[model samples]
Target: MDMQTINTFLSTTAIELLIKVGAAIIFWIVGRWLIGKVVTLMQAAMNRNQVDPTLTKYLGSIVAIALNITLVLGILGYFGIQTTSFAAMLAGAGVAIGAAWSGMLGNFAAGAFMLVLRPFKVGDFVSVGGITGTVTELGLFATTLLTPDNVYTLVGNGKVFGDTIQNYSHMPVRRVERTAQLAGSVDPLDAIVRLKAAIAQIPNVATSPAPEVNLLDFKLEGPVISVRPYTHTDHYWQVYFDTNEAIARVGKEAGWPAPASTQIHRVTQA
Candidate 1:
């Protein structure tokens, strides 16, 4: 071909390529902005309807991901790329990834089921996946927990769902179990009365069901008294410590002897 013709063809191709690149950039920026706005609006709407915050945030994330994927496909189509073939390829890749990362997929599925079943929500004090803590977040693949010792933990949703879930905050009150050993010489009935009175004075103890001070069993040292106090989960630790103090105080006031194991030695005579 002539140099002049070649130069003209090159110039045209360069201009077209630049235009396509510019359009693609604009499309990407516009698409991303639109996706953000859509997600925000949907979240706002859910909030206005008083939807659960956890579910709203989860749905927002899912919608944003789906919208972003659609936007990318649209941009590809605009560039004259066959999006149908691309989508088919994406599906094939997803299957391969799902097979390789089956645990992740299981966690995702478990999260969806948890959302629907409503077993527990964010901020609930629960024991799941062998970890006892307050739920910080119920995410797409994992559940975040802030433990009693202030440790942050992440448990896979699959494990959480499969394990036994203990929701400590579900009930209005929880029973604190404690035991007190009295000396063999101490009157069991009198000790029970003193303990019940002391436990009743402890702060945050539930009044309806009342505290229970019952003789649990007899050991070599003394009779065992079960000291059970009902209190709200939030005040459990406080009440637990206070209950122990009360037991000590009652024993001191009654001047009860310290519990000791009794043993007897028999002397043989010839």
Candidate 2:
């Protein structure tokens, strides 16, 4: 070909390449911005609706990542890069990764269910997967809990869902039991009356159920007093400790002596 024709061809080819590159860059930027806006809007909605913040954040991140991947692929296609072989390779690798990480995927699915069903929430005390504690964090694969003694535990989401869950904090009320031993000489009726009065005085102890005392047995040993009272779940520990103290005090004032074995053999020998 002549120099004029060859130069013209080269210039046209260069202009076409520049246009394609510019279009690809614009697509990437515009796609990214649109994805960002969508993520922001969705996050606002989730917050307004009181959805789990961790879940919202994770979902938003995943969505943004997916959009970026799609934009990158679209840009590559615009630049005349074939994607069929790349897509096949991606599919094969995805299947292999999925097979290798099946357990993790199950956990992720269970975590998603937890977020949607909301059987328990952050700060709620629950027992599941053989672990009990106040939920501190909810993640895609595991949940973090703070135990009663302040120890931290992480439970796999799949195990948690697969096992039975005991949500002690879901209800507003729980029962507290207090047991005491009173001297057999003490009148059972009087002991019961005083014990009930003392339990009633305890703060957070529920009155509707009415605390009751049962005479468990009477042998050579003193009377076994079984006391049970209902209280608000949140105040379970407070009511339990206070009620026990109150019952013991009431028993003392009611002339219920402490349990002691009598020394009768020495007196008989004398």
- Candidate 1, residues 1-270: lDDT per residue as tens digits? 999988997799878888998999999999999999999999999999877677788889989988998999998898899899989998999899999999998998898789778788888899999999999988878999999999999999999999999999998999999999999999999999999999998989999789988999999999999999999888999999998899999999999999999999999999
Look at candidate 1 and tell me the lDDT of residue 235.
94
Cα error, candidate 2, residue 18 (Å): 1.9
Residue 209 displacement in candidate 1 (angstroms): 1.4
Which candidate ranks first by lDDT, i.e. highest?
1
User: What would the TM-scores of all predictions be?
Assistant: 0.78, 0.81
Model 2 global lDDT (CA atoms, 0 to 1)? 0.84
lDDT per residue (tens digit) for residues 176-235 in model 2: 877877765777777777787888888888777777777767656567778888887678
